[model samples]
Target: MEIDWIWGLLGGLLIGSGGAVYLLANGRIMGASGIIGGLVDGSGHATGGERLSFLAGVVTLPFLLTLMFGAVATHITGNLAVLVIAGLLVGIGTRLANGCTSGHGVCGISRLSLRGLVATCIYIAAGVFTVVLFRHLLGIV
Candidate 1:
């Protein structure tokens, strides 16, 4: 098999395992937005330590890995306004949906939640629509 597939499989397993662990340990869905939002808004005070540790691991693991291995190239938009607006929209959308993809797609769907199923469908549809609009119709990448 290709290295890409191996890495993808490893990454997916790690994500699923992490979500499972968080759910089992804390009885909370492992949503990035909810985790960070709780921390910033003081709503996660009951699990502040766990949340902080999770955030720390998330923030530092890649840097630690880079230090051990090498830096990975990333492509990001050069337009700050566009980046900011996109971030805001994502935040707003997640809030409206009550959970992010990780929460709805992985944990919620695993639990057989109708909301998760609907949200995941909506997210995928919106993503496809956005890609078509931006990349095909508007000639933007």
Candidate 2:
């Protein structure tokens, strides 16, 4: 296997463990989508300052990681409009689903949640369908 695979696996393990710890300690779910949505909507129990800090940490962590490791982040060589549209779609989907892949696929699956199982299935199906539609049907690959 490649070194990148090892790193990916380790990172996933760390994230999953951290999420489990958060759930256990705080009696809260570690759903990134939910956290972001709550932060934006200001509907969650967390205070404004706490939400801002949490959101800031989420947004800054990737940059900090890249800086500390001297690793260049992957760049998408696609049209800017496509990227923006895709991002917006993903954000909307996450909000509608109440969580993202990390939340449902990892945390929810680990806890044997029915909603998580269904959500993860839908996420995978949507991803596969999108790839097929764009690359095969639309010849956009």
Candidate 3:
């Protein structure tokens, strides 16, 4: 029996819970872009250690999960240029949107923020359009 849905559901729960806990503990919105951006621009110097710890958990937890449950097939492309371009695009989009999917879709929506809702909608629409264009029209992605 496949446990894909189970894993996804659990991941969602964990993410939601983490956001809630972060909000309660830090009194700040749990936006990945904001956290990293502040650190990169030195605006969050006071919270640099906190941000580093959060990022460490973000990178480490997945590795630990794979170590415990074995690796899962991601079907990622092997092309380094494509990967770099994709990462750059994502970073740019996150900057433009002022948040990421986790920040707007999860935390912002949960808090019923209008800006978050609107940004989430726009990004989702853009994502759908991109997939349709690249996958169907251009056969790129």
lDDT of 2 by residue, 28-109 (tens): 6778888778877777755555556656877798889888988775777477877888889988999888889878888888
- Quantify all predictions' global Cα lDDT against the true fold: 0.87, 0.80, 0.88
| Candidate 3 Cα outliers beyond 4 Å, as residue runs | 1-3
Best by lDDT: 3
User: In model 2, which regions exceed 4 Å deviation?
Assistant: none
TM-scores, in order shown?
A: 0.90, 0.84, 0.90
| Candidate 3 lowest-lDDT run of ten | 89-98
lDDT of 3 by residue, 65-127 (tens): 899999978999887987998899888888778799888989989889998999999989988
Better of 2 and 3 by lDDT: 3
lDDT of 1 by residue, 1-141 (tens): 469998989998999999988889888789888888777678778888988898898989999999999988788878787789889989888877878888888888989999999999999999999989988998766
lDDT score, residue 19, model 2? 84
